[model samples]
Target: MSAGTIALTNNSATVSGTGTVFTTDLKANDFIVVIVGGVTYTLGVKATASATSLTLITPYGGPTATGNAWTAVPNATLVGITAQVAADVAKAIRGLNLDKANWQQVFSGTGTITVTLPDGSTYSGPAWNSLTTLLNNKAAKGANSDITSISGLTTALTIEQGGTGAKTAAAARAALGAFSTAGGAVSGSITAGAAAGIAVAAGENNRVEINNVTSGVGAGNPVGWTVYRWYTELAQTGIRRAGDTTIQSYFVALSGGGGWEFLRGGNATASGTWTSGSDIRHKFDIEKVKNALASVLTFNGSIYGKKDGGREVGLIAQDVERACKEAITYNGDRKFSDGTVIPNFKYLNTAGAAAAYHTEAIKTLFELVELALDKPDDARALIASIKEQSEVIKNTPIENEDPRKEAPPIFDVPSSEDYEEPTT
Candidate 1:
């Protein structure tokens, strides 16, 4: 609006001004707005503006007045607004910050929204107010995939479910280092009471360790640990695969003279023969047995209860050692009930040591029966030979005339005494 003071006339179209530069500040067809007699009038300019005088389009509308305050403005189509039932929004903000009045007005459907911009410019469809909302939603955690990392969560996701299963920051960071078996890595459990960890090694040469942890402290504290392991091999120790040359998995310990041992829960009942290596090529100094019957008699087998809840008839190791020292073996690994070390456990060779003596005795018994079976045939042959010799003697009787002498000489020699062991 142009700054001015103007004089008005009562019921006249002529209007005059004092100190108002109408030519420089006011123009034709603009409205002259003024208040007179406590009433206001907006008059249209009828002619060109001059330095001191102008004419209204019609007669003065308000009561007659001399000098009055007025403002001149360019003419436009909209003149006034009239509304009778406009509801007043009680919660409407009285004032707005032009810098922050970005109401991201969104409409769901497709329609043109003509906005009169702050600068009085117009657009059919506006794509603004959006920078702020877009910026805000971009930084939000669950708003979109743009959020790369998040924090301050009350729940944790498990590793098997493709998340780091931890509630704390440190635990989450550590769990991220673990892997899955589907990744071609070995996964197994080795745990303490409530704590757990895993060690992953890369290659076969990388040794997996079973660490002996510190012992517990208390009156009845635990002392040691027992490890149970399984393998792919069905056989143990020195045995080879049934149809392959590879040796079976072995359980080797420093004791038992470093020999491999097979351990189990109960007795082994086999469906096929179990043969021990007895090739003479693997042995030496073979010899025939003598006095096997005497050796068999020396073995004193007795029925006794085993310490492990069973009844057995077996020779005592000490008693057998007295007769044959080779039949006994002292165990190198033994301890007392109180953990005191000792190694006097004499384990006997019950399966193999004295078998040779019994076997030799059986062979000798078979040989005697065969000799008795051939004795009758030999006696018959001898009788036939004596008859032939008598016939020859009769044919030669004339030459010797010794029938009476020969008959006298026909007396028999006695049989030999029973066989006995020769004196040394």
Candidate 2:
């Protein structure tokens, strides 16, 4: 026995041999992995040892049947190993190995797979491949292609049912139908107002003027009416368009006869049916009316014949008063022929300042009358004193030229002409 050789443990002894120093040969707790009689076993530490023989026990395994090796612990879960290999292969295909140098070394350097490429070159490691193939495989086709054609494309490129997706290239290339008519269209409804005939003649300045009227000559009847007639030569300001001109001036006088009529009445002057009493009410205040007319003495080339307002106002008042008085007569005791007591008639009651104006109109008339004809100052004074408020008084008589008197025609030619013999 070697002197230092000692028991390693309670179940173990260390021994030396003559030719071998066991201390140099033996190790503690190291399995002696050995094939014995074609059976493999992992021998535990020798509990006791003498020269060539030792005693040991196998803790993890006994041996294989024909066991050349212990079967590698059934390769430690074959399904799991297979799955790991498959995952590793997929990663390798996706170039995942490039992300890890260790994985690249594991696959590319000396290992189970000494993988060589088809080109007789070994795979060094992961290399980048083009995404073009993957892109092509996942690319979208148009409406005509199968469902899988759009599998991996963006949502904007694909369409589901009832989608209002924009037109495709082929669809846009298709022909469009023609428009219904040539130019752009318009909606219906449009036209004119009144008819043409019986429209008033132009240049009448849209009014009917009458002068030189024979009594009872109506406004529209005999083609020619009085000059200086009220509505004649009238102008309607700002009325444009032919139809507007006609209506503003001479509208067909509406009558109970259900036809067109004219203005004026029986035989007093060239007369038609005149407008109502109100229409000519200003005639009652004839002085004011005539003054207003005479205010615009000359209108568009026609003379007013009223040379002055103060004179014209007086003459017009006298004319109206004379006409009214001639129409009615009075008897003794100051009663009218119909036996009604006559009442004094006055225009624009002149009790105060009005009295002064009334006196002025009267004075103006007497002055005009004197101017028109030769009269004594006494006659003029007598006519001026005639109180318009009460009655007409006269001392020295006065006369006036009749407005109605007509002289013979200015140009006269004899019907027979004196003829000289024709001299060559």
Candidate 3:
């Protein structure tokens, strides 16, 4: 390492250094590492220009920069190996990488590939290029046609014989696209250990699959699936499943709410309507809903504001949890960025559980309705008495009433928008 600060003009072959000793540390073919903007660039030193500067055989093509830190490193020394042997070792390592990643080159023109066996024998075929292609052409793994003679192997096999039925490799690849009846990808498939994924053109369908034998199922996650739908103008939505869908473990993001939270679902659809499985075959011990009347009374249907600056007419989860614990769902505690922690809740409004905690309340209300229905004669006598009492009050004039405002009692539901305050 020599210089403190350096300057290199774009397209110039000179490297000027400040407070540097280039002639003492670098020589003709040695390389100098200059770090500019956090990126290191290695330039070959053509010759030692002077103590304060060194010449580059190739000019600096990067942006012109000054005050860069640099270091000098001579050509790497090879120990116990020639340059040819090092090149061969690199080639062999690259071949292994290509094999593990299922990488291949597609060529339309004619070419030859020589295969060197471990026995120090090399063979090259005029028609076949790779060993895989050559062996696939000659061998019959399934019930297919066979080539009995060497002259018969000149032409490619037919489709019935598991071959592409085309002579050239590119043509064979194109022909293989027509056959899609398989468990694996036939045309454009990238195997496991692929670093960079294969590219897909427009109008092509991109599939993200997890196979059983490949990198699919793993420990802790026996069956896991997630479906994503991207949106350009709005936030994306998705459906995810942790276990099988026969139970209530499926989840789906219905819409963007406070935080676009996912709602748990089951075999029932998460759209609008929901269904409860009431089949006797699937049920263990079933009974009628009791204490529904008590729950209805306990339900404090008051107007409340939501966290999203909107008002809603519903029961608070914490309040209802006290009254009806079944209606309230606990999904663990939620910690906010401001260090505020609160227990999260999920309200299953339509679930039978939403009406839990007291079935006797509902049963009491049901008995009242049944009583009103059963005793019709007694109800008629009570109604006749009420009519007579109402007539007596209407015949008499009230002290503080307006004389013109005389009418029978009228019962109707009033809309809040239409209701107005009464004048004194």
Candidate 4:
């Protein structure tokens, strides 16, 4: 709305070109007259231009012919095309009306688009070229479907990849060392010729435990076989026998067969040329071997007791070996009777002291001294008491007894380490 004017004439004589021209600068709300073919009309000018040929526009809702409908000003915006322009024909012809789409219509694309309605909220859609319009139209209720808008999708999209769900949480836990099933098939590689010791619980299935156990490192894993094989080898080698090789391999093979062999090694009397190439027999089987060697070392002997000649052996007395063998036989050592190897000795020696003699008599003497020393009284007191008691019993007369019978004499007490046998 400003000041200026344009003149228009149908005849060439009145106007410069056959259009409108203005005689003077017209302020806003100015009016002009035009006569064409003897018909005079008044035109309300809304805007004026200063070009050689003036241009003017008619303001909206200014005036119109009595029978003709008013056309909207060119390029003019209206509020809520749906409600404002209720006529169907007017809305249909309107360009770029967003409500041209229904409530369920969704526009999707890239870039920016501004949507202006006649009277409703102002929204933005993408520009014509930058964005794509995805209009989702859903029915009343045949299926529950509605159009929803998704934002923040990038321009370049690859649809082939699917979501990898919950991977972050899976990576947070600790790893396990070994896995096995109670009864499932398993396979793995074992080193050849690597020795390993194995212990299988008794009463388990009596079958070959490991696969390919011969001559391989796996020979070490026969579940209680090492003792027999190792000792057999040591025994044969210690005696410098040719059978040592056979003994070693035999024990290795026999381990799975539940065989155990016990052997002792040391210099002994040569039995028949002391055959350097002969194999000696080990005294135990697998089961017994496990028990005996459970505590004894093949080379070192008993763990708790001293070496073979130590106190638990025959070191305490020179005659202990003879005594042990005799006692063993006297008690029917051939076969256990009442689970005893030797009969308990309790009687008199030839000198008639309350005594029991061992085949190795020194052992009996040591036992007697040990028993005496184990008593509460001092050694001197005990010895003195024994002497006094001996005299009393020796001198006392037996009532109603023949005087021709001689009294029994007490044998001299044996010393623990050094003792002299009484002379007749």
Candidate 5:
């Protein structure tokens, strides 16, 4: 049944039609019979179809009026009835509902079906394929296609799990620095080669040989190899606080019942400990005494003295003040005839001033020593100055004396009678 209308213009190739006979109802290449202007024509074949229009291969007779009745016609047949029956049979087969078993029977033969993946890899096999096998194949293809063997691995290797790309070993090493060689130096269970000479054990018995050769030929000189052994031990029983711990405790422990002597020095803590054999103790003693003498020579009245309640001795503030006062020279005030008292020369009574004075005194004393060694004339002049000061001190009067001509009487008598009245 058709409820279609065609409105054609003067053109004979295309006719505009509005109808229910479009793609849903009629397919391309389908023939339709139309009657226009009361003339019967079987002229148009559907080239394209839409809901409201049909594009025909050849337009119907031009200027056809609207409301033309049209009907879908069976394709023209070669043998008339046979062709029509065959077409009907084909349409019936297309509409039939075939179940899975019937479809399997129809597609029973094995055939190759190729499928392409997103990564441009293809899989070819029967339609039914193993999911696991397909996935493994995809992974293998990805690994092979993306990257082959990576090169340029030498000094080190970096296995970066998540980053832009693989980094070179040298680049990683440059960033992180070299690994420590201490791990390689460790003695393990693996044996050394025979070319390594003798293997040294981890004890005092381990020794290295030294070769000594004489250059010139003279009398045969004695060549001897002496091995000196020094042993020390430090032991403590209980835990101690960091502030309470001292070097003396460690020294006592390390001495191990030997005759130990302490050498005082500029360093408050013990510099090092010595066992019985070496001259470290003597060397330390010399250094300590020399340093002590130096300190005394430049004393400036300050000494490393003990605090009132504390055990350790150091330069105290009061002592430093006293040293400053002693080292600086103060000039007395001058009085002029005009009755103006000029102030004494001002000097800073400070540790820095004291140190400067001490340094100057040391320098002067050293100059005197140099004079005594090399310049006798300068030494004599210095000695003369000392003698002149000594003479001035020697001649100075100890007590004041009266300048009167006659000796003054000790007691005053009230004339001659004052004494005579006292006799009664």
Candidate 6:
């Protein structure tokens, strides 16, 4: 609040001031009025303020004098008015009787405002209702209601908003390495193990080994195999072994029951290949395949050049193959030829081969049929013969008995007339 008096130094360019003046009290490009030898001179620029002494851009043109008053000229517009004058003006505006007719003469224009006074007090302008409505629409927080702690803020602060606080604009950035200044190249490598490996870069061949990875192991099993342990053994693109260009990649694995098997990689031209391993054993159930074939094959006596007695003819080799293709369920390795992959039943391939294999296959099929048809009749005949033999044994007489003699009755029955009437 005090406008200090200037004490001119021996040098006309430098002058000292009294009463709470410091280097921060003035800034560059500020207009200052100084009184020297009862003559007032306005300085265009205030170069610096240092501990009550001021160095000016242009020196005073009069004799060096002590106790000369110096005052900083205020800016023209009130938009950026100093906090000191703003507080005083706000106080004066609040003290005015705004409802009086003279107050209307004081204000040339009509506008609403919520005047915040110097003593932390507030006054509503002429349009109190509209001012409050506008203030409500502004969504401005109260002075104390505004956030005090920044712990909840997640966004980076701006330079005007106190910045990151770790570095300054004037600080050298060489410690960060490789920073350019005005198109000049600044180059450096971040070497590893220099400062406890904190800024170390990973090497080209450096690998992070994940130890003891047993993702799919059973309980109490050894922890050595990773989820991709099988994949790591094979090359990603081509074959690994020498002189093996056709075989792209492969992996070998042990079964839970201690059996080993080879797994072939997929053909990119075709669909993927099945996984290789002893645990991947998936065979067509022989019994199930036989049952499925038997259910479709039938013996039609009229089809094979016989009206009454003919060989089984309903199921030809082609029909059996078609039925096998439709019915058979298998997950084993298949021989694929430029066609749809199907359950490979080698016996059902051709008529000649089928007939050859059918002879063997029908041996079992005929056994099933003969057991179903002829065995029941044979069993019935055996049962009938046993019954006849049992009847003959009952009709035939004993070896020591006479042929003409009659057997004695077991007991005699009395006549109805000889029987006396019994009491009721």
The candidate scoring highest on TM-score is 1
- Candidate 1 structure, TM-score to reference: 0.29
The root-mean-square deviation over C-alpha atoms between each candidate and the true structure, in angstroms, is 33.8, 32.7, 28.1, 30.2, 30.8, 37.4
Clashes per candidate (backbone, < 3 Å): 0, 20, 11, 30, 0, 2
- Better model by lDDT: candidate 1 vs candidate 4: 1
Tell me model 3's lDDT, rounded to 2 decimals: 0.54
The parts of candidate 3 lying over 4 Å away from their true place are: 1-206, 209-276, 337-339, 344-350, 353-366, 369-424
Which lDDT tens digits does candidate 6 get at residues 1-424? Answer: 3366777654477767776364555666665676666677766545655657767777766776788767775434222565668888876776554334334433542465454444556665655445444555343455889744443345545545655432444333433332534333623332223112211123453322222333333332223221212322311111223232232233323322222222232222213344534342564443433332232333112344321223434333334444344322335433332232324322233343344435655665565567558688765564455455434433444222122323432345663335554454
lDDT at 319 for candidate 3? 45
Query: How displaced is residue 218 in candidate 2, in Å?
Result: 99
* Global lDDT of each candidate: 0.52, 0.34, 0.54, 0.32, 0.44, 0.44
Which pairs in model 6 have colliding backbones? 23-49, 263-276
Candidate 5, residues 1-424: lDDT per residue as tens digits? 4666765544564555675655665666666667666666665555654566667777555554666667766554324766789998886665453334334533552455554443446665554334443444332334447743344433334334422233555545445443343222422233334323222223554433221222223322212112222333332121112232221211111225432222222122333553245455554532211122223333334334321222433333333323334334446643333344444522334444444545655665677789989998998797666455434433444222222233332444453222232232
- What C-alpha lDDT, on a 0 to 100 scale, does residue 258 get in candidate 3? 19
- Evaluate candidate 5 by giving its C-alpha RMSD to the native, one decimal: 30.8
Off by over 4 Å in 6: 9-11, 20-24, 74-424
- TM, every model: 0.29, 0.15, 0.26, 0.15, 0.20, 0.17
Candidates, ranked, lDDT: 3, 1, 6, 5, 2, 4
- Write down the RMSD of candidate 3 (Cα, Å): 28.1
lDDT of 4 by residue, 346-403 (tens): 2212111102232223443354588667863554564565455444433444222112
Kindly list the per-residue Cα lDDT of model 1 for residues 306-349, writing each as its tens digit: 43235667776654454456666766644433344434556788
The best candidate in terms of lDDT: 3
Model 6 TM-score relative to the real fold? 0.17
Return the lDDT, model 1, position 216: 44
